[model samples]
Target: MLRTSECNSEQNVNADGYRLITNENKPPDIKYSKENSWVAGVQMFVSFLLAGFGMVAASLLLDLVQHWDVFKQVSEVYILVPALLGLKGNLEMTLASRLSTNAHLGHLETSLGTLIIGNLCLIQCQAILVGFLAAMAAVAMGWIPYGEFDIHHALLLCASSVLTASFASLVLGLIMIGVIVISRKLYINPDNIATPIAASLGDLTTLALLSWIASLLYSSIGTSVILPSIIIIVGASLVPVCGYIAWKNKFTKQALDEGWVPVVSAMVISSAGGLILDYTVSKYKGVAVFQLVINGIGGNMVAVHASRLSTSLHTGQKENSVLGKTTKLLLLMVIPGQLIFLYTIGYLRAGHTSLTPVFILVYMSAALLQVFLLLSISHYMVLWMWKLGMDPDNSAIPYLTALGDLLGTAFLGAAFIVLDVIGDKDSDLGD
Candidate 1:
């Protein structure tokens, strides 16, 4: 009886030991249950699908909006559509990225009324300036007759559109941040999801706002005193509101403390350059001054290099070779794209309407080229940084985008002049 009891006890001990080993080996599977895994897969799939659709839809909507009746009546509206939509996308992306970072750092607040209002005012200022310049450019190029659309009318319509779009973007940015936060809680990647979604939404919202503003302008004012009066009232109200915000936020002090001098100087220089270019193009007859302006502004690629040098100085990082390579790659890609865009604009203005097919081909080619170049440069830069024992994300890609815009515009202008002069010589000989 004693021997039989001992054998049973030994067998029970062996069984218990096997159970422990099995649990330990199956930990990974246990940690990821079938339900949890399925949910994660579904979420990721949905996010990616939405992102793809959003990009495609936004592109189509922008094309449709450009051809809408109001814009068709004023052909310069074509240029305005791209400029405004690009600005909207860029701003929304910036704001969304900032908010996402803040959310990650636990610094974002739900109360965005003040922020939204402030952004709206800034956007209005930008839109008015851009609209005036665009209209003036069209007039100078003879794309639109000068007296047909006054600067004031353009400014008012633009301001209304900009204000509406900017407010909508702020709300969208907030929503994107919230989505990002939720995704993070679910252990999903937010960076891959937030920016693209925000940009797509911004594009659609901008088109809608522009359409609504056009409707309002046509129905309510139709080129009259009421329109001007509304613009004045809104502009006046914005001044005080901006002033109040500046005071409440202590923006002056903040700016000074945070190295605002360089930034402000850059902005002032850029704006002044733009205005001078506008004036020169409008007043002069010898050359395409708009192209000159774009080149002058775009060629100031010094900002990115300066930022890089500053980073290197502060961090004692030695990556000059990598930086040079990346910058060269970007310039190669961006310069050609700008040139093609400028060429299309010049040809279109010169009454080469059939060149539209060529323009489309060039645009698509440049876009694809830019994508590949950007990806290559970004990958190499990141890889080089990783090799050097540093976080690539901490580098200045964000600043690069703005710097690229400036340079791209300048390059486009230069290309336009070259192409236009060649075309003119051919025409003169034929005549």
Candidate 2:
């Protein structure tokens, strides 16, 4: 039997050989070009811009729907829009990242049968749960009155969002895999290309899905609109049946044994922890619980990745175990710092209302800057490690994601603090 190390090494060799053979025969792809670096940067910048626009657009739409006589009866139902959009983007990003990782490992199959269906079911369940929580939070915050909102409307909106988002995720996953494959053919590192592209596409897809769902819900179209929704649900449900038939005919049950335990374990732990943290924060803090839950989960994921990296290194499989641990430790330290920063910003923003525009502009500017910095730094770090012979899938991608999340949160929090300080000084001078 092959040892784990031997198996890993063999995989790495195969991956490297594949890359070399493809590059030798193909022209460089778009992402491989130095010119495309600027293109990717521009795309990412536009994504950030669109994220802000999406939020504003959602807010305005909510206001409009709230005032409409036709929607007045269900106006409170509109509050779920922002939350659903947020979850749509987030879940799409998560699924995209996982698919990208699988593609990099050459584990991704083109057959859209079982894998696609499984993902759709999982994402739909997740999206529905998130939508419900968002609706509940909106009620708790008095953003929408509890008695004004129909639970059925909320459920319908949640179902729509999940179906649309899941379909968008599947399409985006397909596109991302193609892009990565082409990038590999051109001698470009797919890791550097996948996340940014997938994230941008995820944002765009989320916006489009939100708009489409809203149209379906509010348009003159009747219940016949439900046909599309039903089709998606039925299609997803059929995946397991088809997969079982395929397995029974061509493969043994033993084939499913590999990596099942670890994948299931990670899913269970992450999902449970996410639920508990979300519940705890929501009960105590209300809608603002999103930031804290995101921070905590992101931080813990970094800790877990650090632990895994350390184990891998000690077993003589890698050289940069300490690097992973060190990066994670630094990010862990920054968590408290981030919380303090967020609190300080909230206090200042509340106290200095006159400087609100300045505060908002500065805060947004800082967030953009932080995103750019985080992307650049983390990208290069992973590339450097890869050059030093680390496996991109096992060692680089997880750490990079964790680091990006940690730094992104920290920088966003810090930006708010800086803006607050500036606002405070301006207020003091006016006094």
Candidate 3:
């Protein structure tokens, strides 16, 4: 077992008894050195810029939606979209955050042990479990009124979600770990660069994989049923086995114990967001493009905060306070992002909708509210997890971004109501 349960700031001494240490415990001096504020701001600016493009790239899902034949055939795919995206973002974001924290603690280099293997196993297991549940949800919900309760579709949804999630978890998870490790070696704050890159890349890769799998299923229903059946059996079988390993290991146990709250909550909330998108996506030409971007940017901003707060709590620098210098700087970073994306991308692509002040106000208000709520929740979640001897990095980003998806969707729907943006309820869902 790794000696990671130690919490005392004073006891963080080196092996030589000379107080020498690594970068994990010693965060960069940005919080203390006022001179570093400009550098911090510049780094965050670039990070969010990448995040904006990354999220916008994910809008290619809208392209899939435009294919009327495929879309009408696979209506449940709409429901699967947010859940799949949320699953990818949640799993990868958590991985990036945890790796950053581990790098900070110098425990990252100890890679050949049970903890590492357990984490990899846990990621795959959770992806499969969550994917299965999400597909079941889509099937169950579709049956209620839509009444498209074909077992074939359910199997496709289940198999596709599980396969995409597992594959992405393994591929993107390794890519992110490598990125975090390299960035840290180069003196870049993995906290700053890691989360956005992981999240954006996660969005891109997950959607691409999902599209491929769904297209394959559409190509041949027989092949789809056979392949997914095998995948579901294998994936379902491994869940318990992986759960047992995570339960036994010291490092992964804390994660396993606490992972469900964020994952389930995010899924439930993202379902709500999905419903809103389903209702309005047809009427609002560019809403599909902007929804993920807004949520992505909002989530990315919160991830940076969550990663920083985790480091502070672990290193005993900032306690649980959310209004520190770093928080303020991060909060400031969201303003221009909201304006730039909402005006340039969201507005322009919104089918020549007038850039009225009311539109801007409603959108900005919703985006900022989402950011603020995520930050507050992240701060408290980190504090609460820390109090219980758990690592917040394991769950914080996942929780925040999932909630961001929920709230961002809610806020957007509310804006639609206030401004009457969604026209003719029946027409909104036009075939």
Candidate 4:
């Protein structure tokens, strides 16, 4: 029996020159033993770089906030924004985690039958259920305007979330499968590429879908009681029906059993962050872009940690043993990424007229604090879930990303406040 520790080492040369098997069930042909940790880390970082671009693109959604009357009038849209963005990222990350695990285990079959369809069902089901829940939760949290938490608000949230999630999942699911296949062909580990790629695509596609669909639904028939009512009833009804199917279907059972708790918890947490973001968006110009970029990069870092740890756990590595390596690697990778985010955002948003040293210091300080907190949280969370016999893949990304959003928003807001206070002090000194 090959021990898991040896799997991490360079491939061994046995007496007959046969490679050691990573899994007893799968042959050596399927396992990526030679890829090593550094290779995997580099691949993940590259994928993350690409994911960064997708995240940056999500800033376009903020343009709607600046320009569209509908988005401007509906405070609920801000509530919907974080939840929807987080939802898309959460679902895709989860899906990619699942697929990566499948690829790692050599269980990824030649035909995309059971694996693909079951996961799709799971993604769509969660999208529908979570979408409705997110809207309701937003209302409960009072993220809506004074008079806007009515039937129309509920209908718009439910309809947009459900419809957009369903559409996005289907499209994103196909894209992930293609990515996995290509990675295998290219001798790259799918585990390294799939999650970030899927996550990036999820952010870009879902934001576009949610914005267009919500606006389309609201504008054409918003005033009519019948349209929103139909959306509410039908969408609400599908949740349980989908739940029942997920319970019965073998393909989707793992997702149903394991996927919900974390994703829903994340959505609720993200909605809290959304509340903060919505309140502060107008007060701080260019913060919307900051929120999207920080959350995206922060969340992707968590996913990387989670995916790497999940693969480790699945391959029989001890949780504690892998934790240090993951942490060190995460620190190395996340620092440069965060630096890139801070410089790009600071320069693009603040540099046109004048870039102050105080502003730069505050931005770096706040952003670093967020990243430090996130990395520490992710390390412990993955280990804790593993110790508890829960799957980290199912729990980690959702919780971490949501919390990342919450903390990222808070940190960014606090930075702005610091900048304001210091600016005031400087003015007084001059006088």
Candidate 5:
């Protein structure tokens, strides 16, 4: 959109000719470009606020939705949930990451509009493909475990997933384009801000869409399969059409070829995390309330780290280790940032006060550990991906954020187990 206006509009067009105001004529603001500890801290803190709130809302909605007849009748959606949600990291956040990297490398200056449109289309195409595959995986997981496969349920998951993903990607892609363009214009680092914002918003919107669509489809299942069948077929039909268009675009062409492994792999990884979520929530219901917050925060932060390092690699900045300035600062940020949300979680949710000093200690350790390990992984992962001639923006985030989800979810479950063990010990001693 900006391409038609800002990219071409002449500053002085009142006379016989127009004057182009080039980047050479307009210098970037000194304040916005220079990121010190304070600026980075402020950005990270503000982002964490939005991230925490959005995830809490998504988690609450999920808790409510799971009780509905749709989810209860067909449990396969549980298997699909994390896999689809992971695409927020895989498709949408990766788009943000790619846009941020392009912005930093001055590609935006040359063709911001084309970059935005191409990347947005690419993400939508990816969302369709991955969403379809994730649905299949969910259907298989739901069937193989029970030895009772329902083609009706299978079709529902596929339709719900493809439609939700396509809709969510279109919505989130627009938001990403707006966020990246505005961040660049404001001299803020899109890398620092874009991925988390996309991710946080993606979780909320995608969850809402998925629940609503699934419920609608579930209600109609007894009467007709026509609706669901049309959805899957049409969605399948678009794959090649969108794929061809994305392949034609220079900004997204190479990405079409090399990034499938990470997306599909990340989906499988997140499914395991989702399985853990199911088990943990069954034993400790409180786990669902905060799992989204803790696990989401971990993934959001690491996704940011991944996005930044990817931008760095694209800019020709050699990153030899994970112990650099940003790495250390981000690592230190995990404790304070996570504690604020943990406190908020305690304050807002009822009867869920696992905020005992002992529990807090365990949770904080998990938060810090999740972030630290993910940062280290992203650091080297991005570098290695870049060296092997694959685009890190496309490949690295899916894996890192998926791993972040797995680690964060597992550690949270572990924290609950630890709290239980200590409580049992205290009771024995008291008795």
Candidate 6:
């Protein structure tokens, strides 16, 4: 079910169904270089700042619109939010990670033209299919459990999810290319820089676009169904056209054939988080606001960890000596960085929580556990995938980021539940 083909490269799939690209990778593995701890600290901290702004912006936007009819009426928009955002991690960040690995391997110097075109085309094709599937998945997840299905609601969710995914992928894909290209020119590792920027903007762009598009389409509902229906049809139609272009390119056909287990499986995992969000949002007053920031921060930090491990593996450094230092640096930033965001949320105009001692303890506990586990997994995953003949660049990121979302969402939800329980017990004591 997995295959990767490159010129002069021998490829075979393992019994576990992962593809191994062998012996003849055209670019030589560069020896691992010592990264200055100071340079890495600054790079990741700056990236985290940008991500904080983005997460805050997304939180504000979601807060501003949660009472709006589009959210109230569709309900599945909550489902779409995480699913669509996860698509960015799955599709765009993966593209950035692959391109980063290629840049390190010197492919950009040797085969820039074909690699760029084929990669850009490949993601577009993926975005179309996965976007629509995410939409359908959102609709099904939102409705089937409750046995409540509305045609109009289904149509709106699909249209908005497609529009958000298509347009966001296009825009983010270009931005990621620019980020990676600039990183190469500056002699900065794209792994330390690109993925966090992608994650930051990914949440910001998808949330803004989804809200705007859903709002625009929602206004026409009951009055007219023309817009949503056309989007559903056109978005559905693009899958094949994009697929054909991607399939015809010798560079991309292998990935096209590789199909969607990683991305789709990631989507399904995020939907479980979405269901958690839906179930708890009303009961836990500010959980939705914290969800985007918690999930984005956890995912963003771990993505940096995963991308670094992938790059190190590609450079043929199997020892933890170098990687251990990198992990410590990344984790050091993660603890304090998340603390800033949590307090920043308290300062936000709406969806503000008291930031009580217990909540901080509980919330930080969850975030810490999520990142630690993900960081631990990243090193092993890249090594395991590489040994299995699978390209970790293409495979590891989506799963890591998606799992980050699930853990962030689940733990954040639990934090709020715990906070409420203690408050109730205190009320009884007061009486």
TM-score of each: 0.49, 0.45, 0.84, 0.85, 0.89, 0.90
Q: Report clashes for each candidate as comma-separated counts.
A: 4, 0, 1, 0, 0, 2
Candidate 5 local lDDT, residue 346: 63
Better of 3 and 6 by TM-score: 6
Residue-wise C-alpha lDDT for candidate 1, range 293-398, written one tens digit per residue:
1321122222222223222322223333543542453344344434544454344343222233443344334333434444445445544543443322233233
> Highest lDDT: which candidate?
5
Clashing residue pairs, backbone N/CA/C < 3 A, model 3: 24-104
**Residue-level lDDT tens digits of model 5 in 1-431:** 11213333333222322222223323343544456767876887688778778887887777677678987788778777778888888988888888886676466777777787677777878899888988888888778778998878988899999999999999999998899888988888887888889878988898899999999998888678899999988988887887888777777877777778888899899988878887776677667667777778888888888887766554434445778777887777778777877776567553244577887788899988888898888888877776665678888889988998899889988988888877721221101
> How much is 221 displaced in model 4, in angstroms?
6.0
| Tens-digit per-residue lDDT, 186-298, candidate 6 | 78878888888998898889899999999999888777778898987897787788778778766666666654778888888888788888787766657767788888887
**Alpha carbon RMSD to native, model 2:** 10.9
TM-score of 5: 0.89
- Name the runs in model 6 displaced over 4 angstroms: 1-32, 321-323, 424-431
Taking every candidate in turn, the Cα RMSD to the unseen true structure, in Å, is 16.4, 10.9, 5.1, 6.3, 7.5, 4.3
| Model 6 lDDT-worst window of ten | 422-431
Comparing 2 with 6 on lDDT, the higher-scoring candidate is: 6
Clashing pairs in 6: 19-389, 20-389
- Whole-model lDDT for model 2 versus the true structure? 0.39
- Candidate-wise lDDT, in order: 0.39, 0.39, 0.70, 0.69, 0.77, 0.77
Q: Per-residue lDDT tens digits of candidate 2, residues 238-268?
A: 4455445424421112222222332233223
Winner on TM-score between 1 and 5 is 5
Rank by TM-score (best first): 6, 5, 4, 3, 1, 2
Ordered list by lDDT, greatest first: 5, 6, 3, 4, 2, 1
For model 2, how many clashes?
A: 0
lDDT of 4: 0.69
